[model samples]
Target: MAAIAGCSGSDGGSGGSDGSSDGGDDSSSDGSSDGGGGSSYDGQELNVLTWGGYEGVSQMVEDMGASTNLKLISSDKEGFNTLQGGGASQFDVLVLDNQWAQRNAKADTIVPLRREEYPAAQEGTIIEKFNWPYQTFGFDGEQWAIAPRWGWEGMGYNDDEVELADLESEGYAAIWDGDYKAMAADAPTSVIPLVMQQIFDLDENPMAIEVSDSRLETLEETLVEMFNSVEAVHQGAAALRQAMLEGNAEIVLGVGNFELSQLAAEGFDWAKVIAPPEAGGWFWTEGLCLVNNPDLNRDLANEFINACLSPEGQRSICWDGESKGAPANTAAFDAFSEEEQKTIMMYKDKGFEAADEILSGLDQYLISPQQEQWTEIWERAKARSDL
Candidate 1:
């Protein structure tokens, strides 16, 4: 079973809330003391600030003869803070959520990539859907980052306790059915968008967080009701899993298929994740971004990104055993085993066409300009639940 720690924020960026920062030994040395003498990158050190489960990509880069210094970050917010606070000088690359990647691009915290340099990240190598501007990772007519993996936020339910037919028919309305003990993951980024979708009946661009005064009021009301009705709001995957296994919660909100996969690994195959057909669920794409630093090795940074776009690098990210996601590389997805594809909920009986259709139906997670308001509303809703 995948053990979850206390959650601080949504997994939309990190993929899993259980990620912890490795505060020690940021540098990694290759066993060869000669420091890859013959390689073009010879003694160059590639500093990477990445999501917890994605540190494996650094090793792939290191194998190419560049020494790497890796630091694990738990959320995109943290990554943004680091870069904006002058931490960009410490790292050459950052694995960030698409929304934050765009924000950083606008803020000049990260530099744009030359399409000509990264052949692996060019068109035809990655899924075409992710190639759009401001949708996956492109911004201001330049590619700000290369998205390598993606996932979604949906409801996880115990099949034995809740009827699958009801979920499919009622959609998100099933959570408020009052028939099952419900719980939610304490992730405002994910939860707020989901509740917004339900209250506004927004099927398209549901992740849009900008709202007028009147619309904000309506969202607040819906969130208050949802929080109050749930049996508990779990802070970590472990708590969510424990609640379901112990029969404390029959329906879980603000989670994804990744959690369901974790449950299945524990021999509890009854756990399942579903995006309601009507409102749909939230989806997030994580990208590899180059930090904006004059001292940084641009060639080596691009090389690291190219390596990550490779089939093996994509596999290291999507099937890392700790956290699983859908690879952005078409070749990487094609290489996945039947069971691996099923586990990531990328492709099952349906082929790539079906998976692409599913991606089309979902909303991409975007950074809200009025984030303070969103956070305030979420806190108010949680307070209502406590009452």
Candidate 2:
């Protein structure tokens, strides 16, 4: 699962903790010299920097007989900082949150898309809801990226260990019940507001968290309490899953669908993912962007992106594997069998409408001023957790 994706920085700009660029090594793209007068880049390699889970795309591209070598790699906040530092040449494609997307677009760190070039990005191919201007990424009619996956961040609990009824009834408060061993994904966007919601009955949008002496104290106090309740605080889903499997944690804070799906694939289906209606969660969409790398074969990158957005690519990602997420393409959701959709938690019996309602409750609340504040307090909270 792609959790709270962000980097410590000033408003709308990416910067590392030490204020320097860090990411993938810059390399020249070597296009395959296929025998078709160099028209086909079938055996070419496309360097990709993402938050993981693109194996589906790679597999699908291969199935189509393209034989493209997908140099799949992972990244985190550092990747964002790297992009902002003008390191876009290291990779041909990047998967980023819309907030980060805006920053890259504003900074001109990525390429503007001409939809006519990418067939998969056209109207009938992409999901209707996400095909509008700037729906994924754009600025003043200039498109830059397309959404491949979208989901919410919340709690994932062991059903056999923690009562589902308790979670539903008490909402996010169930994490602190003192009955189950808990662990949290360490991210300010999820942890801070979640603690505020569980402890203080906060009903406002989490992105608009109020910063004040009293609130800060309450947050600090609550974070300490949460830290005391849990075994460890982690920054990655795989780590959280390992903690749960090792019996160190039975309930996980900030677990999302992507993590749950991956866990399910590994025979850990005992956990149930939930986004409480009361406390709510963050709704986010991750867009796929083409890096404006001059040495890279631009045509190959476009072709790879097109193949990734195809129904097969989307299907491979949303289902048919471990890396599960809600598909950005509506048709991809339909491609799943009745049981598969239910198993993946993509559609509850009411079809996509029910899914939409659940997603509607979550707000895309990452903005300026508050982001810097959140970062500052988060560092302090982590330190306090040690105490």
Candidate 3:
């Protein structure tokens, strides 16, 4: 299924006609803004690569007086592969997962962002948890990416078949219960960490990247067991949702509240997401990064980033009618109506403090240095014929 498009309306927050707070002159008919004698990137094309349905970002960039060429990608792996294959120079801005952003920063495939240049990128403008030096997207004392959207991955269960209290008490162990048929996404990044937590019986910091050789062996065994126990392994949110709706599985793993919300909207009110009590679920963020292209127009690119961080921009990027994820910019909550805020998984009636408190309890998804090794282990587990 195609990702849903963002809800329309709103000029993308306070600023000049170009969607920037720099007090620039009105954009000319040709889509070029003169920022108080600053250089106008006339006729320049801002090439952006992001997930499908993030057109709100494109609109923000276009409003900034630049022609935009937006390329939609299906997965973080696809985006990372594109950059690794020397395609970084083709786009000025790229939106990727936090871990992928970390990889690109380490590979020098993306440039560091100057926080001071953009008001929206500065300290206190966005959620404090996503600020600079946050391990997920920051490293080497540089801000490598700006996370504009975030959500947590947990088990989605049919309320009719499973008790919330039972899942919470059992935590990761709930997936191993032989009586309950389970299904999961094919995403190793989303599944492995939780598996590790289960194997280690860890109550906190389930995202530690370094895995010792002995731990790897044990993890392999556990993964094989978990895989064999599941009803089937599916790819994409659509397939997972289908399995649950068809009663092929009573529980789905590696899905977030966003998916559950989508299911509820479709009249599957019994669908619900829960972070296992013992090992809090994993949280993921979508970050916007500057591609390391020498030919890139830095000024316009920065402007685009700034615009996306605005209140209206956050609403456009984070909410689509059915699925509501938290915006990195807290001020964006103001753009949403009370009903809309209540629908947001993180925002609910309590507001930003509530969101922050919930996030604080969840584990951040981090880049595992041995990711390839983990994938190999996962594949080997999946290949085992004996249950």
Candidate 4:
């Protein structure tokens, strides 16, 4: 999402990777049997905390308005710690990035989801991805939360600024190839690894992380090199997009919101984004993890997820005819025109098929350990570079 764009892939069904569920109405083991109050509005207050820009809940409300009358109350959190502190269940649903699930689930900050209890989280293509090799929200085969949207993790460039061939062939060379400055998402402890991930992917033992004491030296070395060229670090996607729009920055190095291409219809340049061919990671597998709240509106939260997964609900969240955040509901693809679908489709193509040893190896090398050691070294590396 930051400068070097590599998004986690999600879009109802783009056909990438083997682990994700088909995401449909089929129930998963003794699922939620609780009957939600049918659409009477019942004046119930449903609270949800999520990353900024998620449309899953609001769109669902509109979709089920005729059937589930209760209105959902939602809020936004920019980071994970906010969700870890006690009081997550106060809201009916908590939508968070998937990476943080294991930690929070263990702390009991978020509760395991009873897919059988809620209709939306349990049904449709949207929530299906959670049933994987890493289901963190629930226990013994139950789900903890749902994934309403996912991002595409691959390389991107401003088409207007560079040719696609050079990008795919040169790999990071494309961004570093020119005199142009390379800007990436910062919070080195958090974002630097994404850039380094691409670098390690190009080396021996592509699946190995450079985090071990033996590997730590390698992580430091790789980051030091990357820091030499990185420019300003964006705070968030909106800020990143605005940077590109204003000419304050020229290139990014992470997941792409292909829907942004639709901005061309409104005059935003179309030539900036490019998916490098060397290999990349999907954006973090974002799922509906939670921030504990005491006033959880269990019933409406369930309805909210179900509605957003609906075809009609998915269409409601589309921006400029294409959904900015990829919808997990396979049915949502219909929301965009054929062309918009084509642009976004590349993320799934690249990720599901590309060499992922770099990303998987990184989990052990830098990101896997509970401690944030590499994050610190990365920050010092950043300080040295002044980026």
| Each prediction's whole-model lDDT (CA) | 0.68, 0.60, 0.65, 0.44
**Backbone clash numbers for all candidates listed:** 0, 2, 1, 63
Using Cα atoms with residue i matched to residue i, what is each candidate's TM-score against the true structure? 0.86, 0.76, 0.79, 0.67
Report the lDDT tens digits of candidate 1 across residue range 1-387: 111221225423543334322221222221222235457777778888776555566777766777887676656767788889989888898888756777889889999877777776555667777763435577778888887777766788888888878877777766666677888877676666766666675535745546679988887787777777888886566678778889999988877755555566555667777777777776667788889987889988887788788888788777775446677778777667766666666222333345577776577766555556777888887787653
Ranking by lDDT: 1, 3, 2, 4
lDDT of 4 by residue, 137-160 (tens): 345464555655544444445556
- Model 3: per-residue Cα lDDT at residue 369: 62
For candidate 1, the 10 contiguous residues with the lowest summed lDDT are 24-33
Q: In model 2, where do residues sit more than 4 Å from their true spots?
A: 1-47, 55-73, 81-91, 115-129, 134-136, 197-204, 208-210, 246-248, 294-299, 319-322, 346-354, 365-368, 382-387
TM-score of candidate 2 relative to the true fold: 0.76
lDDT of 4 at 285: 45
Segments in model 3 whose C-alpha atoms lie over 4 Å from true places? 1-42, 84-86, 203-207, 321-324, 338-353, 385-387
Q: What is the lDDT of residue 301 in candidate 1?
A: 88
lDDT (tens digit, per residue) of candidate 2 on 276-384:
7667765556677888677766776776677667777777656654446677777566676664554555222333435667666565535534666666776776677
RMSD of 1: 4.2
Residue pairs clashing, model 2: 1-258, 1-259
